[model samples]
Target: MSETAMNAARMIDMLPDSDQHLAYELIKKLVLAWDPDFTKLTPEEAKLLNEAENDEFVDAEDIDWSQIGA
Candidate 1:
């Protein structure tokens, strides 16, 4: 893996379950916003992200949406 990929993996691994899911989603959004090729992710990274999406520890409802005011 490239240094960036290895760093991202290590950072993700260090996060709590909730934070890991949040980071995965944030990274996914950033990738989409930048319109990068999705295939840039290695299979292992993709698998880790997919697993994060299925994790139940992160509660969307628990987030303080008011802080993101329009």
Candidate 2:
């Protein structure tokens, strides 16, 4: 383990049970954000992203916000 990781683990070990659980949760969230799985896009997803990039967007005032529950 890296020095920083070792130090963090030592600090976490000193925490109370409740704090340890909280630390674990925060660590898990950080680890997940460190690697997102977005290598492949479904056809429908690809189409939406493509349209967003290439299409003319609706004007903010023209959108019926309630219709989309926004």
Candidate 3:
């Protein structure tokens, strides 16, 4: 994989499962804004790309998973 693709994979692994969908949405928006020529990504890859794209530098403990169920 290219460095960009590898980095994206790592980012996806770091996200909480609950945030995966949101992550994918964010990635798609970014890809659309930045490069329309970006290859079409599978839903799974899109989710991972999104997570990586939006990943904020923070401790995982900062989020409250209990509140996510609402």
40-69: candidate 3 lDDT, tens digit per residue? 787789999999989977677998878987
Identify the runs in model 1 with alpha carbons over 4 angstroms from their true place. 36-70
Task: Count steric clashes of candidate 3.
Answer: 0
- Rank by lDDT, descending? 1, 2, 3
Off by over 4 Å in 2: 37-70
Superior candidate under lDDT, 2 versus 3 = 2
What are the lDDT scores of the predictions, listed in order?
0.87, 0.85, 0.83
> For model 2, how does the per-residue alpha-carbon lDDT over 1-70 read when each residue is reduced to its tens digit?
5678899999999999999999999998876687556456656778989989898877899978889964
TM-score of 1: 0.48
Is 1 or 3 the stronger prediction by lDDT?
1
lDDT of 1 by residue, 8-29 (tens): 9999999999999999999889
Model 3 poorest ten-residue lDDT run = 34-43
- Please report, as a residue range, the 10-residue window in candidate 1 with the lowest summed lDDT: 34-43
Clashing pairs in 1: none
Model 2 TM-score on a 0 to 1 scale:
0.50
Q: Estimated TM-score per prediction?
A: 0.48, 0.50, 0.39
Cα TM-score of candidate 3? 0.39
Judge candidate 3 at residue 24 and give its lDDT: 82
